[model samples]
Target: MSEADLIYTETLMQRGKESYTGKEIVILGGGDGGLLWELLKEKPKQVTMLE
Candidate 1:
């Protein structure tokens, strides 16, 4: 991942937790689904993952 992507993800995680809002997650490109799985643990309503 690029530096910008990392920053954005960290920011998202923080905001999501603070606001207690589950995001409708979406991913583009290809890679492992580990991140999505982790997000699910945070009780996100749905993950519209595309890989």
Candidate 2:
């Protein structure tokens, strides 16, 4: 991935931190749990990822 892509990803992650804070998150089509792995970093209130 390019550096620009990495920056964009970080921006989105920060946005998620704001929007998903103190909320239950359900990630549909979380294939291979890749998204779950990223989310686990934040340690949100709750997360249920269905693949």
Candidate 3:
């Protein structure tokens, strides 16, 4: 992944890590699936990808 990719993913994941647990998440425009992959590690209640 590119630096921007890492930065974007980590930045978002870190910010939401605590709040994501057992919560429903809606992801829009994460076509690469990187965000989804990381989000799953947090074990959220549900994940919906619009794209």
lDDT of 2 by residue, 1-51 (tens): 456654654564575456555667887886555556666666778999776
The prediction achieving the highest lDDT against the true structure is 3
How much is the lDDT of residue 8 in candidate 2?
Answer: 56
lDDT of 1 by residue, 1-51 (tens): 566665655575574555324756666642555455456676776777676
Residue 49 alpha-carbon offset, candidate 3, angstroms:
0.3
The lDDT per prediction is 0.59, 0.65, 0.86
Instruction: Give residue 37's error in model 1 in angstroms.
Output: 1.1
For candidate 3, report its TM-score.
0.76
Least lDDT summed over 10 consecutive residues: which range in candidate 1? 29-38
Residue pairs with backbone atoms closer than 3 Å in model 1 (clashes): none
Clash count list over all predictions = 0, 0, 0
Pick the TM-score winner.
3
Q: Give the range where candidate 3 is weakest over 10 consecutive residues by summed lDDT.
A: 12-21
Query: Which wins on TM-score, candidate 1 or candidate 2?
Result: 2
Q: Local error of candidate 3 at 29, Å? A: 0.6
